[model samples]
Target chain A: MTDLTRLTIAEAREKLRAREISSSELTGAFLDAIETANPHLNAYVKVTPEKAREMAKASDERLAKGEGGELEGIPLGIKDLFATEGVHTQACSHILDRFEPRYESTVTANLWADGAVMLGKLNMDEFAMGSSNETSYYGQVVNPWKKEGSNQALVPGGSSGGSAAAVAARLCMGATATDTGGSIRQPAAFTGTVGIKPTYGRCSRWGTVAFASSLDQAGPIAHTVRDSAILLKSMASVDPKDTTSVDRPVPNYEDAIGRSVKGLKIGIPSEYRVEGMPAAIDELWQRGIEWLKDAGAEIVELSLPHTKYALPAYYIVAPAEASSNLARYDGVRYGLRESGKDIIDMYENTRAAGFGDEVKRRVLIGTYVLSAGYYDAYYLKAQKVRTLIKRDFDIAWADGVDAILTPTTPDAAFAPGEITDPVTMYLNDVFTVTVNMAGLPGISVPAGLSESGLPLGLQLIGKPFEEETLFQLGQVIEDAAGRFQPQEWWAS
Target chain B: MSVDIDTVKRVARLARIKVSDQEAERMTGELNGILQFVEQLGEVDISGVEPMTSVVEQTMKKRQDKVTDGNKAGDIVANAPVSEDNFFVVPKVVE
Candidate 1:
């Protein structure tokens, strides 16, 4: 038979329902794929084979009874950011070394309720801080996609890099990822995968590791738009655990797939046309507009004047929130601890040893901005700028614009160490952070290949709680661009 | 809005993260670069704009003032680096 690991979630779901394959078989195939690919890709930080087998067996029994959940028998990789009960829940940071949670995140709990099997915890940037996976204490996750005939390994964009890489490499049908500022969408662009960061509260933040509380959101990464849609339907819900989670009914997002975009207004923000963007990214974005236009979407040229300031403002807001949220890691409750002569000294020493450089830098930035003399000049100013950024989107929505389209990243995935300057590295989120700032839903669909044979993606930004619209528009781009997958160079 | 070595050390202390003198010197330049980049926010006129407290407009949800979850002290400290009788063990501070 064909590789069961290669089947999309929708296809695998049908096959399992028809008894064409068993959940055990499908789960085993993914486990085998992960076992083979993980050493090369470093995508999975921990593989839960026994737990997967146990879950698969339960799913098989449920399937036999004609009573299965929406994601029945589907296997997925969990980003390490989510707290899985009795499982490693590190956010790819040494600070969380050997930490296991007794509680499950509301999002992952929802997935399990739908009968999705957990393959393992995927790697991510430490505390989901960096754009590249280099900040991951577990090491960088290699992008499965390679430049044409080049042996050099590329970074799967982060901090959802492992989620994107695993889906592209077929280690899991889909994976859970979170975006504080473009973590989900940017990495999805780097790999040939579909990722959606639903509106800020679409998924509960109950047990996911907090990066930037106000900006962080959980979403899914998958090989196909339909798979992402399916995963999201099960992932999103209003939870009492997370007050920010909207009290809205979870729509069947899968139905939005293949929905027509006839007469829809697609906004093309002129501000996204940043200076010095590569010609290929611009061309791909143009192609996305054309694709929508051909599908009956009226393109409107618009401007979000605050777009240029979004990144700078985000650096302040996110790190400020991050420093506050991360203060809980005081070396007393859980994870790694370094002893000192006193409690305060111990806290300092533990955090110093536990956190990586990027985390430390951001924490210090946060502390400085929130300090006695700088709060108004820095933190409050960034918040005011954030208001202007959100106003830009609110205006666009009020003008009857259904969704906005843009290139997901400024360029295709780069090789690790290609860019070192922290400010330079932050530009990766240029196209994505605005969605988070505005509390909007955004989806990245692989649209084309770079001149170097790397995958490029186009993003769709929708209004709050309008993830279905993004899924619909994302399918249009997916159908137009077709799928881009890497050759199995690592499958030795 | 540039950060000096002294400011970097002060911020690191406030953040409760130890930084060596050498690391603080390097961090000074890095933090200054970021602070300079964000200084552009000063240019945007915000005389009337309110600082956004939340992205989505929602009143804080109130729940009944009753116990919902409890009696899991063991689980709470299950992963603690050092624990005794379900209580976390930390360095003594009240000596």
Candidate 2:
């Protein structure tokens, strides 16, 4: 039989319902694939085989009685950011050493409610802080896609690197990921998969580790646009535990997969053509515009003047919130604890030894911005810039623009350690951060391959609570560019 | 705005994360690099914009001040690093 691990969520759903494959049989296939490929890919931080088998057995029994749920019997990898009951839920940080949550995150609760089987916890940047997954205490996740004719390993983008790599490598049907700035979209773009960061408060943030609370939103990374839509429909819901979650019905997002983009106005921001952008990225953006135009959609040239300031402003705001959010990891609480002579010294020692360098850097920067004298100059100013960034999008929408399009990342995946400077690394979120600043939904769909044969994605930004439009436009791009999967080299 | 060694040290203390002199030196350089990059934000004209804290414009949900669910002390303290008699243990604050 062909690899069951290679099936999409939709494909697996059909086969499971037809009684062609048992849920346990499907779960076993992925476990075998993970056992063979994970050592080289490093996509998963921890594998829960016993838990997976138990869940798969339950799903199989449910299916036998015609009681299958939407995600019944499908194996999915979860990012380390989400809390799974009694599982290793570290956000790939040493500070969260040996910590396991007794309760499930609301997002994961929703998935489990719909009968999705657990594969394991995937790796990510430490505290979801870096552009590359290098800051993780478990080490960096290797991208499955390599430049043609090269033996060197490349990065699977960060924060959700493991989630993207796992889906792209066919280790799991799909994976859940988060985005503060561009954690989900950038990694998806880098690894040639589909990722969506839903609007703020679209999903509950109760059990997930906080990065930038106002900016962090949960979404999914999957192999196809329809698969991403399917996973997101199961993932999103309102919760009393999260006050920000909107009390609105989640539209059946999969219905929007084949929706025509006819008569929709797509905006192309002039400022996204930044200086030093590579020609290939520009060509990809142009191709995306042409694809939408061919689909009977009107393309409009627009301006987001504050776009250039997004990266800098994000650095200020995200770290400022992160520093406040991450302060709860004290020695007295759960997780790692280093001994000291006194309470104060104990906190200092535990935090100093537990956090990675990148995490410490962000914490210090956040503290500096939110400190006594600099609050008005740094934190307040960044918030104001954030307002302007949102207003730019609001204005475009008010002018009848249905969605905005841009290149997902400035470039395709870079070699591990290729970017050393912090400022240069921050630029990876240049095209995607404005969406977060506006608290809007954005998605990266694999559009085409780069010159070196690695995949590149084009991003579409949608208005608040209008993820359906993005799915519609993303599928148009997906249909035009076709699907891309990397040749299997991890097994070799 | 350059981040000096003392500023880095002060911020680390404020954040309650211990940093040695060597780590502080490296942190100073990285923090300065980030601050310098974000200095461009100072140029934007924002005389009347309000700082956006949350993106969704919704009123805070209100409910009666009643305990909906609780009293599971074991579940709450199950993951604590140190617990005694179902209470979280911390260093004594008072002499």
Candidate 3:
């Protein structure tokens, strides 16, 4: 009984199997924690306490029969972006007000097949658009970690902010999150947890709300590297429903934990040392290099020459695709609708009223880039730039680089309203976006604390479908840095 | 490369989003700021590079073109704002 909420998913699984604890007890503990913490953190948009209890009871039955799934009885948070059957699946956008899918997403279906219980839908940036969680219609998810001795609230870095903050605050053992750019990794870094954006096609995008379709991917955010590895094994699979989902068999990722990094080549790109990055981040990056080197990883100084262009080009490509993907919300089939004099007018009114400011800006930017006059200058050019960006990684991998190491974000978590400009906010993904751009796997492992006492994370970028390698390397970093947890100020 | 207010309005119309004169003006500045940021892409040399069609390297998977899923009309319109007879109701398009 030492705070059942504090047990990692791995520990809880063992305890549940041994009958030392029941899934009902574990689920109840998480529900109580969420009820206490959610008011202050705003991490959960919807809590399925009844459903969770029912699921836990079912899991207890399965466990008693010794026939439970991999994640049997383990409670987790689901980002609002994923469609949960008959549950709130808003993607934190008012556009989908009170909308619930009749069917489940393949990823969530996969988790349930492995017996994971859904605690609730976690809050996120509207349409998964912002770097900070402020863009969410439910309001920002406050970071569980605070600056040393400071009472000022900090943002849990976003789109997946609720997932990270919930895990860090022990609201849930792990949470499902999607990454388009750095949604999963950056928030995990900010909240002192482990999150991985498995390669683009690793998890089916069937039920997840579309952001930038090509860049969007689903992954897990958990308390420890091992927990993340365990969750991912159940989450990733080849699905025929999504054409982009690769046909390869999903590997047992847990086996990669504690795997030696001997003879591995860790690439440290010169370009990621961006101008105006705080000295502490650079120092942390250096420490990561030394840690990997100590673990027998050969460090190599290399260059991703087109690194500078990746973000600018991403702004164009992502928004362009987002504009197209989001065009489905025309007040016709589902969600919010604003009546107008005519069909065209209705479409206009609905979208204008439905989408948040950040979403609108991106949609407009997307429209402008794909417009007839500017298509060649913007969209096509950005695509070509994307080619070069991917080529940079392709070359590195061809040269025998096992993985690339960098800081997860330019800095640690900041106050909610500190950043207002869109372009400035987009820079938060600088170190992490290239992985999504190249369709490669990446993991962010909490590494150390910033000078301000907020948590910082080091990221590992791996070859396509090489998430096992990232897990192996991420465990090395986690082993060196140790786990970080925020002081429980909210419950009191 | 900056978008003028008129162009912003046009783009808003094209995107089927209503923006007032004031919102469009504000968006003009914001869009210009982002356009200026992305203008840096012009510096990259793309001599003979082809625009990437897909990020992953794979041939498109083909499935047998047969009737597999249907008969869930009620489920399809489960969240529709207005629906009847298993069909989504929208504002009349044809005059």
Best prediction by DockQ: 1
Measured against the native two-chain assembly using Cα atoms, what DockQ does each of the candidate structures obtain, in the order listed? 0.88, 0.81, 0.87
Query: If you assessed candidate 3 against the hidden native complex, which CAPRI class would it receive?
Result: high
> Tens-digit lDDT track for model 1 on A127-170?
99999999999999999999998999999999999999999999
Q: Which regions of candidate 2 are displaced past 4 Å? A: none
Clashing pairs in 1: none
Which of candidates 2 and 3 is the stronger one according to DockQ?
A: 3
Which CAPRI tier for candidate 1? Answer: high
RMSD of each: 0.8, 1.0, 0.9
DockQ-best of 1 and 2: 1
Per-residue CA lDDT of model 3 for B15-90, tens digit only, reads 9999999999999999999999999998999989999888999999999999999999989888899999998888
What tens digits encode model 2's per-residue C-alpha lDDT throughout A33-110?
999899999999999999999999999999999897899999999999999999999999888888898899999999
In model 1, what is the error at residue A19, expressed in angstroms? 0.6
Worst 10 residues of 2 chain A by lDDT: A1-10
Alpha carbon RMSD to native, model 1: 0.8
How high is the CA lDDT of each candidate model? Answer: 0.93, 0.93, 0.95
Report, in order, each candidate's fnat.
0.91, 0.83, 0.89
Give the Å shift of residue A382 in candidate 1: 0.9
Q: Cα lDDT for residue A27, model 2? A: 95
